[model samples]
Target: MEQLFTLAGIAIGSSGLSAIVVAILNHHWAKKKNSSGKLDALVEAQKVLMIDRVRYLGSSYIHDGEIALEDKENLAEMYQAYKALGGNGHLSTVMAEVERLPVAEKR
Candidate 1:
């Protein structure tokens, strides 16, 4: 009877050990999946913002050259585009021209 009880205890202990190991593995797998999804989202957002900054910087340069600042609606459109695209990049010191632009003409 004593031997039977000892064998049962060993079996239970091994099962518990396996359960703990499996739980740890599952936790690591979940974290890896979540981080992968976040990384993909960040990359996509960066791509969009890069495009916007490049486009705005080009248009702003042209407008600055072709006469006095005409209508700021163009600049406003650019600012919002910048915000959507991620807004991190900036143009050359020349692009300081963006601030000179107003929200819109008084109409």
Candidate 2:
């Protein structure tokens, strides 16, 4: 009975230690997954915003015509937001295309 109790105590101690380790690992993984999810969301939002900006400008806006001052402001604001969200410096294709659109000079 004494040996059995000793064995049981050892078993319980090991399990408790293992449980703490498992909990720590779980927390780390959860934090990593959450950060990944947030980054993915930010990228998606930036893509959508870029697409919308292009659509708003149209081909004419791309060629000879200039984008409205408001459009330019919105694009800058969105790009800032994207950067804040940890976007890479490499511009998205849509973003590059939109950047070529001339902003109307303030008179």
Candidate 3:
């Protein structure tokens, strides 16, 4: 009975040690995985929004020149898409955060 208890304690200690090592390794891996350029999706999305802002100015009366009605229509579609994506105002904070992320890295 004494020998059996010793063996069981050794097994439990090894199991705890193994679990700790695996947890440390997983945290390291996760940190690296999130560092990829995955965040570019958001950056590119922001870039697209900035361009549409310009288009909005050009198409609406803001430019003082009447953009072709077709151009105006296209601008509307862009605006709608922008709105669907939480809109320019909603992304203001997100854009700031995205800008902080390394342009070469992901979120």
Per-residue lDDT tens digits of candidate 3, residues 1-107? 99999999999999999999999999999987776556756866765865557454543443343444554455556555676655556434433333233222222
Q: 72-104 in candidate 2: lDDT tens per residue? A: 667667666766766665446545666777778
lDDT of 1 by residue, 14-102 (tens): 99999999999999999999999999798677767655665566575556553234444454465556556565545433245555544
* TM-score of every prediction relative to native: 0.46, 0.51, 0.44
Winning model by TM-score: 2
Q: Please identify which of the two predictions, 1 or 2, would achieve the higher TM-score against the true structure.
A: 2
Which candidate has the top score in lDDT?
Answer: 2
Model 2 lDDT at residue 27:
100
> Against the true structure, what is every candidate's RMSD?
5.6, 5.1, 13.0
Name the regions of candidate 2 deviating beyond 4 angstroms: 62-107
In candidate 1, how many Å is residue 20 off? 1.1
**Between candidates 1 and 2, which one is better according to lDDT?**
2
